[model samples]
Target: MSSFDLTEDQQDCLQELINVAMGQASDQLARYLDTFVYLKVPSIEQVKSEHLFETLNQDLKATAVVSQGFFGYEGIRGEALLMYQPQDSHRLADLLGYEADELTFDEQIIDLSSILTTTFLNVFASQIDNQMSYSAPRLLSANQGTISEHLNQQSFNWDLALKVRISYQVTDYSFNCDMVLLIPEEAINNIKAVIDRILEDF
Candidate 1:
């Protein structure tokens, strides 16, 4: 089997691609919420499934996580998770113009996750000349446990995951969230091939 790791050139190419995609997603999100969105540089790396959450630089304590699965051509597939810190939930509710009731809050969380996941992945897939389909976004945990604990309970078919981490913050508001893409080992080779073709074209 091919190695899951990407070459330096492939990594650079993929990161650039994701940067462009994220820019578009950020624009759409800003328009949707009528607020400026701040984005951090996205990082991509391969990590053991067990150490997934540990790789993040941010403290993910008391997070509410929503996960959605997406698949595309060339075996490009993975699960995308949007994690929100509960402390910002009220701010998010305010931005959405919704009451901070539990039911409405939960519904808005899923709605926001769906928007972020679909918009980002759709742009990313289009860049690679592919289309993606998504599964319903489900809430994994709601301010109940650590992000690591929530993920540990779930089973992953692959040992290694290509994790792409992107963080978003709304200007002048404490609303912040992290979007993570977990691509299995088997899909890494496919992604590498696609990156190679893109590099060749440039």
Candidate 2:
């Protein structure tokens, strides 16, 4: 069995690949909202399941969370957590020219999560020559407790997970969200193999 570790070089390659995918996702978001979307550099790390909430708490405080599960060829599978602050819904709805009613607010949250998760994962999977499928984006929490609180309430089966942290912000608007992609331990070897192949081709 392959050790559950990513070397420095592998980590760099993965981060670069994620950066490209995130750039594409940002472009799609910009087109959807007709506004400039600023993207922070994405960070990747291995985190134990027990410490997931602590890692999330260090990032941002979130009041809303959308969860989407994705699977890819070669055992690459995980869940993506899209978290937003309380004010994000109102700001996003305003950008979309919506009145921010209950119905529209929920719709906008799902819509944004779908766009970000699908676009980003599709591009990333393509780089690894993998086909991807996703579950419907479900709103897990809204106006709830802190991000850590909501995250702790869920159950994670893996002992360790590869966490890819991504953030998006819109200039001139107080709108921002954090996305955490958690890849379970079972898929680490498969991902490392793919990365190794890509490194060889270079």
Model 2 C-alpha RMSD vs. true structure (Å) is 2.3
* Alpha-carbon deviation at 84 in model 2, angstroms: 0.7
Q: In candidate 2, what are the lDDT values of residues 1-202, reduced to their tens digit?
A: 2378898899899988998887887787788778888779988889988888888877465578899999999889999998888766677767765667845677788878887888889988887889799999998878678877776777877798899989888876778888889998888888998899899999
Q: Compared to the true structure, candidate 2 yields what TM-score?
A: 0.90
Lowest summed-lDDT stretch of 10 residues in model 1?
A: 52-61
What residue pairs are clashing in model 2?
A: none
Which candidate leads the pack in lDDT?
1
- Writing each residue's lDDT as its tens digit, candidate 1 over 101-172 gives 745778888988888889899989999999999999999878787877876777766689899989888866
- TM-scores for all candidates: the values are 0.91, 0.90
Q: What TM-score does candidate 1 reach?
A: 0.91
The C-alpha RMSD in Å for every predicted model, in order, reads: 2.3, 2.3
Global CA lDDT of candidate 2, please? 0.83
Poorest 10 consecutive residues by lDDT, candidate 2: 96-105
